[model samples]
Target: MADLQDDPDTALIAVGGLDDPGPSPDKAPKTRPESGAQTLEQARELLAAHPIADGYSGVAQALRESVLYDLEAGEGLLETDIPRLRDGGVGAQFWSLHVPLELTGDRAVAASLEQLDLVRSLVESWPEGLRLALGADDLADARNCGRIACVLGPVAGPALGDSLGTLRAYYALGVRSVTIAGTRWTQRTGLTPFGHQVVREMNRLGMLVDLSGCTPETMRRTLVVTNAPAVISHHPTPVPDDVLRQLRANGGVCMVACTESSIREAADRLDHVRTTAGPQSTALTGAYDTGTPHAPGLGDVSCFPRLISELLTRGWSEPDIAALTWSNVARVLRDADFVARATKSRRPPSVARLLPPLDA
Candidate 1:
């Protein structure tokens, strides 16, 4: 296998959580705060109303809404729209299996699994044009065929049962990666007595140990102990100083979360790690609906392009962007033979570190 971290051309952008619908996925779609991304009407109105901001809220909101309305509407949220946007330039996404704690009786793992099953059914039932991809090849194939490739994973870790056996099952079912814990500790994996055990098991099973939702201690311990390259699926960059050090020491991967946090914030985090880990560091943009945040005056959808463009101006490059947006993530999933086989040969050709040119 090629040394992925050394690959110069391809990088992966791991988007967290495509599994559970929003807190109110079924709620009737609305204009403003009702939807994180904008509707066509909202986008048109926003452009007519004022100038787009240079931050995350405005542009992302507009772009997401534009993608959905322009490409996806009746096909449902997870159908054609997301891939279209990625093809349009959003990058690979992690189809999250998120279950609200309230609705799941705190059985997040089981709920997550059920949601995964739901995704499976949807993909299985996909019309002739759509399919669910589990590896780098699947994404490569999709990209080659002018289709969007997605990885089936989680936004939070609580969704996996407490036992290593359950984690193993997830891997067995083509779940190539996972975030360790989401928001809190759970009986099976994170922030508890067995946290170390879970990390060890994940390493043993070759599953990526995601520290996206873990506490500092949990993140610290996981980075220090794990043997393989673990991931922080959806987290702010520059990780806390200690975590960065731990990640460097452990030779793990740190995926940037592009959630509510700004690109500057994410960039700063990435820079911090790069200072220590060298230029090989990779990060992902948060895919959660940050287009329209809860904060007042920050929900506009006209700001994403400029915000992202400005990040490029500031020092981030296209390949860097590609790493965060596509290649880095592709590398991770491609590493998994199971996902590769499942997704067919769509995965990118092997390489070392993220670079700009590829035969694909």
Candidate 2:
């Protein structure tokens, strides 16, 4: 990660949130990448008209660790804040409710609720900048009102504790996604029988099955059972090319993370997704506030246009870039909602549970 403190994008450009707002950086002189001045300008126009719908962020973890660092204050300690997200052209953002993998059973569930509450508080504190979105409709409503739509989710699947009732409780509480994981997560194994039931329940409830850290075989197996589309949320490692192809066939999006040390690597990673998975299957995420966002080009959330410019230089068409930034993710969410409505007629809430229970 390059030192972004010296970058014009962050240093010169003013970015802060309400109650401690900085001078607006909107009029600051822009940096022209090798992508050319014309392409960069075009990128700005594209994002302005249709902001990106990011798939993952870890701000909850940041809030959990800091009592002094405030998102509303837009402190220097964090990669994402309201003002930067405003400048970044993020219309909709999925905020990860982080429950550490080490925390399991009821403890994991409790931790998830605490993190979710933090995210809710963060959004509620900034009604002017953020909106809690329960579905695709809410995402659009937030955008129309000039709010960054906040989609909440738990990054650890253990939060459910293998209880279908608990899954329903999460859905009722506005958790639209959950990262699939377990002790066997690292193994090249498919989902077990209970896992299939969980997938079914998620489909019926319209919750997204996130396959961020899932093994290739597990992803494939989940795809086999999932009626609603899935997402490969931001993960440290690159997704396999084969998995991208499968996700495309499943009407899913693989959110390419921009958590790289440099903007060039992030752009290349996104481009790789385009090449391997086709354009419609590609989307963007910064994995911001996860301690990995370090590029000067993407020093913070406000630098989305920089990434868009680099993509243009790589020969991505304007429409394709627009879809990648907005339409594709929107379509996935809509499809999930539609499937959930349809699946409800065919299936009821599942009664499945981990037979012996993992905690015991």
Candidate 3:
């Protein structure tokens, strides 16, 4: 609840969802136009009229390093999805290596590795249009070269097993960010002693701590402990005022999701709810059962343009929108990368001390 009224600069605008990479146009299911088609059409018109300038090449140099966070495109993403991102002016995206919370221990680690392999393979397949970005400088380089930069992020703390060594190994394998507590609150409560240790380790490794699926307590505590800026990659709006202020103070970001559910909530057409059952249940049910018309899913990257238009309609200035979309998050990435490079010789903390006691 950073005041959007008196402090226009602090309004946390909800951006679009993680890229979904839906079926290719040829394979897409046929359907009638939906309710927001007109709005979407208008948005496209605006984008065409005011295309997002290519960083350095366009009017907005600050936007050159723009990134799309929390993209859960997983293994289903295809060669076809690349063009959609390029056309939307997205220079970089953080592809989520999301292992389901149900798959713990070795299974979780294996699933995560497989997902990472898939993302690397996909980038290799489209080398001309895509490149694997390990740090912020890589993202900027990709933008300069006109390629879509892809970064790796693992969702949930369990994916690292009980070892901080495994976490460092993940960084060695190319993961730059981590969702500390996934959609469920299982591993360690954010306020707990063990959770603070995890946050500290993540900071030492230069890994971005994503709070997208964390509980309120977890988010608040993580903010207090994290040395680098955290991100609520895809969250609902009308976020509590206190949380907003805290996020700003920590220099974190809450990327407003552009999915049907998040859009409805931001528009005051739906109510927000906390899900206890995890991602599958939340995906099946949504923020609220308001029966609101479904907006286009993440597969259609066109949603970015529509979101931009929507923000403009609400009187958001160009600079504010640019900062939310690119500048702020880019700053976090840059700082994290600098730390990762500087701490090349630092040893990771012991796994025994990092994990909490079974009974505790």
User: By lDDT, who's the top model here?
Assistant: 2
Q: How well is each residue in 219-334 modelled by candidate 1, as lDDT tens digits?
A: 76555555455666665434687666566444445664444445455456655555554333354444444322322221222233333343444444433444444554555543
- Native-to-model Cα distance after best TM-score fit, residue 352 in candidate 1, in Å: 36
Candidate order by decreasing lDDT = 2, 3, 1
Off by over 4 Å in 1: 1-71, 74-80, 83-88, 103-106, 125-130, 182-193, 236-238, 260-277, 290-307, 334-360
TM-score of 3: 0.67
* Candidate 2 residue pairs in backbone clash: none
Error of 1 at 146 (Å): 1.9
Query: For each candidate, what TM-score against the reference?
Result: 0.60, 0.86, 0.67
Misplaced by over 4 Å in model 3 are 1-80, 182-189, 236-238, 261-299, 339-360
lDDT, candidates in the order shown: 0.46, 0.76, 0.51
Clashes (N, CA, C under 3 Å) per candidate: 43, 0, 6
> Least lDDT summed over 10 consecutive residues: which range in candidate 2?
13-22
What lDDT score goes with residue 111 in model 2?
89
User: Residue 62's C-alpha lDDT in candidate 1?
Assistant: 30
Return the top candidate by TM-score.
Answer: 2
Error of 3 at 340 (Å): 4.6
Off by over 4 Å in 2: 1-35, 183-187, 357-359
